[model samples]
Target: MRFQNLMFLAGASALALSNVANASDLTAAEAVQEARRAAAERTAATEGQEIVVTATRSAQPLADAPATMSVVTGTELRRRPVQDLAEALENEPGIVINGIGMTRRGISIRGMSNEHLLTLIDGRRINDALANMAHADFDLGWVPSVAIERIEVVRGPLSALYGSEALAGVVNVITRRPSERLEASGLGLLGLRDGKGGDTGQLSALIGGSITPSLGVVAWGEYRHRRRTQSPLSPRESELEAREALSGSIIGWWEPAQGHRIEIGQAAIDDDRARDTVTTGARPVYYEYQDHITRAQTHGSYTGSVGWGELQARAYRSVLERVNERDQNQTPTQPTKATDTVFDGRLTVNVFAGNRLTVGGEHRHETLRDSTVNTAGKADVNHNALFVQDEWALRDGVSLTLGSRFDHHPAYGWQTSPRAYLVVEPIEGLKLRGGVGKAFKAPSLKQLSLGYITVAAGGRFIITGNPDLEPETNTAYELGGTYYGRSWNLGATLFQNDLDGLVQTNCVEFCGVRGRERRAYVNVDEARVRGIEVSGQVTPLPALSLSASYTYVEPRDRSKDRELAERPNHSANVKLAWQVADATEFNVRGRYTGKQTIYQADVPVRLDDYNLWSVDVSHDLTRQLTLKLGVDNLFKKRLAESSALYSFAEPGRVFFAGMGANF
Candidate 1:
């Protein structure tokens, strides 16, 4: 579809959804507001901590939560020069930017791969259909920057609450809520590099307010563009792909009567990216590749106060359409589509004194359409799950949580995940927490189909699917503690994850054939990952604050008795922020990444370590206007220029300026 048509359709749908008056109940909104109010009132009482909902699917103080969690507020995001979700989260502890095939990046927590991490928006999973495609980062660009309120990250397996895809952890992006009063905000940014290519620009706007005493609406939009960078040694081939992205969302809420609330939301994303390539062989060839992807989602939920406690139900559908084309030999365009539909319901109530219980069930259906699936060009799968969680207050300042989930899949019979967590407060300012959990990820539809085949490496290799594959599973354990002081806080966690039945491709046909190599998917790997994370924050003066975090991970392939690839052993982040004046703020940040080992064409390659620094300044010119300036990669470090084994480009020494308006 054309950009104009896509935007028009998305805008029209958002407008229509915003005008919806009668939908579900307002229980969720009311609960969020109430939680915020309570958190504000407790800001200075005893322990100063924020309230989080992702830990237990309900509002609770961070200090008392039984899980290892982190929160990045919206205010902190606006202070940095972040163009994407990965950039915004690079500073957090236990996070690494893992490169997928060549250019795509995904989040890796602890020592786990990106495939093990599950991402969600407002507690609903964002379908990851593009995961099967090599070098695709389509899932990270769905949410607009202006619509985000906060992000909650859990650093361990959460399969006890969520079903599949929560094998490693979860990241939930929460959007802003509608207000009773009129509110609006806008931001514009541009960046320029010292070299020939690699520039960036972005624009975003958001507005939200009440249309009636019982109704409210919020809408937002964003546009981003980036130019591809050129390799200094090889100017004919681009190191990065140029991209243009447009995204928007509209959400409406209604309170038909007291103690009842309903919400409806519509969101869309349109992404276009392309690159140029040149190949040298017996005959020189030039090629141009393009990928145009569009995604749309619709979700509705109802929440209300029930006789027992509270009841909530929700349903949503997500659809992704893509058109991919290459200009070598005038190849025809390849069109693929994927859709995910889910229905979920849950009830929360007090089971007895000092105990709270939650019970929920979910049904999910996924469909994929591609030319490689079969002659019919379609494949599908269905899943059903039931889960229950109970929180018991063993005594004052002590809590224990036990939960489990049972999932049934057509291809795979059944899988059960269980978790046990304990939180203890031994002193006035110290808390200790620990947990153990089991998680699993079902094979993708393409992986489970017998007729699936894909050609890669310029058609030199072919991979086929297997129907006798087993689901990959993980067992994890963690222990952590935190200390809160008047002017400082410290936390540390030790975790280990054991994985079995990992799926990989093996030689199935033409094993010795160089040009006609064939492989089929199979489960043939066992691995273990163990890591430790430590972080601390201190305020030496009223205007100055400093924080730092460090992580050390060890990942090994037990089946091969060797260290895994692409995982760094050590990484750290440090930041210093100062309020120079009443209306001005200055910040300095630094990051260190250790050396890594990767295999290249059956040969082991070692990549060198690197360091990066950044400086930022923001000044409030007026009550409603702000100006910002920043510099990234202050020393101009490029991986391609430093390491012979690395094959990616880094646009170093870039300057950026931006402005924002709020009312």
Candidate 2:
């Protein structure tokens, strides 16, 4: 790691020297003018009502995609004081952000668990090996909303193009890029939040610029500190936890020639101590946890014309490290640490005859090491896959897509998935589409190794490894239609997914020593989930916009005769935004989540339905400065996005105020 850092620094220095030597070739003023021109062209291309999305592994108009998709642009995200991608996605149709305060959280789409949905950053997966068993939280806290270019959410099965875990869908986060010429930009924010616990402070800053026509770079950092009080419903009673985090990222890009690009980026996050306490008797026992994570990735791509088709190739490598600490004076257990690295590549071609072909492969290897005295162990796993897809234009107004994938895992043998989709554009502004596909997720190391323990019977525990666990599979189908007009747009989708071999742990009373229960992972027979989503945007006035979405889900575990955990049957969101004047705007947003059932430690818990409201106002103070204010959970509703089946809680009402500037 040290050697790599040294080499990167040396390479950057060499490039800087070369740029200085060639300074006479271009002047700063000329570079600025060229950058303005490029920016103008990009702005014009994206100014219409039509939105473009690449969630299908190919760039296509959102209206033409067979599945449901939502596009959230940088402008739309900045309407409020959003901290990360999860916060920005809260209002999107058929998507839910189950945030657990600050450190840990998950995203659920179409009534599926967070692990079922795949998240990608610029087409590269964010490795989270422990997500299935414990708190394997992805560090999205460091990804500032101001640094984002756009975000695309694809609903329904996408395993044919994105690989196994995308049984539910995919969320692709695209970061901003520097212009071809010289330009500088900066943004800063300050905010305070008042909740049940107390008040919290937030600050963030971003600065970026292009050094030359072919070289550009961006750097940003943010810090948030708060002392949060525990809710009344919390089982473990304690004072507010003092939370603080420092996160930052730097990205550098090089475009030496036309149709070629290279990028290197690194991100780091450090969090302060968070303590949870439970009173057993006269003294209170505490569980202290602190997490630190860092990730680095590099990618390069080339595109050009080959024969009658356009061919493109891309390759990338990423490394992630996470260190977790759990300490208690009574229990002298060591901390845990894990590291993961991933490499992937892809090749795609587009023919002039309205046919697109895509082929790709991916390899993932992970290692986990535990240091606790009573639970010291190590495990390694590897996975490889190959996939191909082809889209053919059946006619001037009709298209068909066919694709398949083969995946091999160390624990699970080779598995194949196939998919097919059709699109019919009966008219200029209207289209109908449908698709069917299969997807699967391999078992995690935790599920295969860690033994179950019971604390009810004098802390007696039983440990066992299951080598016979099978992979979970899903067969899904979807049908949707979309209509686009000059100022109005609408989309609707109906989908169903049938699942098999779901991992479940069984515990019977007095099954172990001292009347303790035994637990083991077993494959369940079947489960089914069906849902409908409808969303639209209407512009009644030139300066005002109204958007609304509603989703309904019916998820059940046929084998257990119970509703799936953490899935709400009904949910909806409505938003109204108005440009009151050229320099001022106001917006209001509200969400409703229906009741649901959750299972924890073999017990079922029910959560009541709730409604949340938020409001935001922003004003341009000057040509280079802006001010914004927002209030989340305006009704102060105490609602749980997910059941206590997990050891995390959703936050309450928060107030924010911030400002940004261009220097």
Candidate 3:
């Protein structure tokens, strides 16, 4: 044994000497390329490399991809946050979740804020818009963790490839495809709040199998019900409303020949929410409210390998419907509905040297059957876009990416977005990257053609939209570097974004409802959004792993001389996991959300900073079944403690138990 060990060491030394000898007369990029090759040899002996597609619309190793990106695999997700995709991404750099209300959440990427962050499923857009001008929220929780194979996140303007709405970045949820062999899985979880009205439960299942030698199918279903949670201010009434949601999807795949594939899929969601007397304390005047949202989508695609390259043609039709009802003093029910339809297609070519060129187009038609109380009448708009991108590998260790897009909205006219990116590996394991890009968001028809004016609190204030609005645009750039060590990884980015023609309602005078100011939609000249993001991970021991990230953002509303609403200047997250045994593990996660500015009783208020911690453990009962137990907000800190930025009640220290299995 001793002799064998000596021989191995001598061989390793000789290889190291050869690399050192070759390091001379080598450019930094060349040296780094050699190091990457060496790393491939070392790790290839243990695990397969990770391949990502969203960064450049092509499959490539994450280490070789020339972009600022992060990936959350199914395994890592099981040990991280459990609530939703937004929470799962909170631990990553350049992402933040801003909550407007208990069930209302929006994703902010690199401080661009709101709908600027575009979301996609299997490369198709998921339309998330409502006539409600006050809320631009997107439900990241709609996707159950069980069905997600992995989530690819790219931080920076991607409008050049994805078109309008990617003014900030992009997140693509990649679902697990049908297996060549039979497979099945299920999950059941029981969760509850600490006090009255805080209870939740969920169940999910999925199955996939080959139907014939050339065909396969996969399907998934999930149902979740959560009760209204009580608020600290009104211990007797619910501050956050309760809701129930049901969602599912099915897909069929046909591989009639080698390197040729076709797919068809359909997905739907039904969600219902209410704020009746049962949860809210109200007088005889029945101030009752109910909301129902339904979404349906069907898509198909054909991908084939052709001479000199591969060709992919895809198309998907998605529809979103929303209904809102209100009643007072047993009055008649007043209902408002909004619906939107989206169509998208794309094609890609492997030009040469593994480089790629892609082109795509999309169209969205939105109609408001009955406008909400905030606006007026039936309205509709048609939006269209065309985009192109080039992922050119200039050399072995250096690469450049160029992209551009043109968007034409019937109401907003034609506009363009363009971007450029460069990457260089100066040494093995170290990558330096930077990019400058432009992105935009066209004004929705509801925003441009609203004929009704909002008189809040029975005429205390008024807000209206203008039809002559233009598209909101952004110019951004980022510089970052990442180092991949044998057992650790670290990265940092410095980014800045300048926004123009921001479309939002602003108070003419004292815009606050109580301030007796009227709000109107107008293009605010410009605003500067800038920030720094840093992230790192380390595996000090085979049994233990640690990951953490921090973001420092400064989102200034240059038009109003104030920081953006509900956005904190500093935020961070940390996660630690330890394997106790072959089938057992424990995890601890903590998050820090810094102070944010808001309005309480129509007065400017600064919320107090807060830290939350959670812990969980998972143990395999058998090779096919696993048990999970965890508690969120273990310290029991909640909104009632400090109403500074309180929009929703925190689920105080709740215990949850669940089980998952595979067959």
Candidate 4:
């Protein structure tokens, strides 16, 4: 939360596109009104794309930002041959990436899921999906694809300025910073398909400069290995599940004077997976498993300029741990844990002229420890929040954005969220936006401190926890439209959300006291969702580029009246890129989904509808080096029905190649 300064509050630069390379979160008078609305949009006529600053944390373009974000860059993540971030957002727009088999542990936006979004990297919030009780969300697999430099998602509910799970929005990856003159880079990758044992390997590196002139330093590291799974899965596709990951980060910066600035960072990650020996029963035993995850982070930040305008602050410390080992062939249990810790702070100001304001606060602490139950004891959760925002300017084509936040849980004690946004632009290049928000979701810590007890056969079952659970809200609404001609651009949006008190975990039998049977975690009363989105992009000549998107959702569940388990009510996305000459390049993408419904033991099941395609080609073996080739799914599509819970297997057609270098 720095928002240095730029300017621009009238029509808030109605975001669209222009050309930018880092640095934004405006402040100095909204970066001097976004450098005079990007020099009056470079005298019009399309000015060839590039200016996109995370919807409106300042910088705008991307058709003056209508808040349905998407961005990849880092030069399209270094020439895209995707790897992580759900395969670079599986063709963007309304995201999916859940899994049929190609092994995507999770991803689901617009249609919800993935714990209702909210993942940030340089904007804090970290917890890399804690898997247990079969939640199975590997959180974008092993990130670190050359230390990203872009990947912002944002769609719906910003919890008035980001609070609670953002209700289903916010992705924010944004790595790669620090490089004031001296710089370094590296990338090594290897992948192969068919020919047995798939194969996958990668290594990454980055370093930054400056040693005195005010002190500065930066570093990055990544390591990955895979011995199988480059798409292809069939009842464990030849011993599937052999993976390894290692990650690193280091940052330091200081400025003992001038406008003042400071930063500190540390990051670490280690993930491992292995599985093979499968057989069991009739004495053919074996069955194996291994999983280990560790995460550690430390942070510090501060941007100066007090006396009344620009100022930013941040603080962080995090640790996430997970370990699971399974053999069960004879004996092998014990090892399942989840941990979390966070603290944040933010402040921004302008207070006049178009009015700018922001305030922040957050605290989180969580823990989950399972050794396969022991009457289940010890589970924790503690969270607190406070937020505010404002960005006036009700004249010149209009502009507005209000905010609110107040969380405080202890088994749901306070909630309060609010939001509002509006942008006009009655003519010139069209643009109209709207917003209404509120978000919530809290009640983990094993559903408020769970405790178990089992026995079965007709009694005994006793789960636990639910210190009076509550906290599930959501109340969203959005409307959008954008148009930016000259070359082409179009967008549309209409959203709805209305959830409330949802929690779930049932059971009551004889009401406790000896008769046992009383499970826990309740409050699942209502639900509703609605959606419609459309997007477009075009650039007929000068090297080609076209994009498309469509979405129509209707997730319902108003107290069990229907749909909502696995979402998917229709989705689409298409992409194409070309520049096939000097240095060469080509890209293609396609996605479609529809039909989905779940409920195994209680009936209702229906799943079908699929389509996925991908292709990437690139070259630039000089001026810093780059080469890429790709294919993912490319028509191998999967998911021919499988229930009793789920299993779709979609990840087969595989082929890839990559190379990189820089200095």
Top candidate, metric TM-score: 1
- Model 4 agreement with the true structure over 66-104: per-residue lDDT tens digits: 466767656555554444676677678887666423233
547-621 per-residue lDDT for model 1 (tens digits): 889999998989988778888889999988776765667889898888877888767787888988999887665
lDDT, candidate 3, residue 573? 87
Each model's lDDT comes to: 0.79, 0.66, 0.71, 0.66
Once superposed on the true structure, which residue ranges of model 2 sit more than 4 Å away at CA? 1-53, 99-104, 129-133, 180-187, 195-198, 233-242, 279-287, 294-320, 326-334, 371-376, 450-464, 508-516, 599-605, 640-650
Tens digit of lDDT per residue, candidate 2, span 92-153? Answer: 88877653433356778888877788877777776654443255554455466666778888
Tell me the lDDT of model 4 at 564.
80
Residue pairs in clash, model 2? 197-229
- Ten-residue segment with the worst summed lDDT in candidate 4? 1-10
TM-score of each: 0.91, 0.84, 0.86, 0.31
Q: By TM-score, how accurate is candidate 3?
A: 0.86
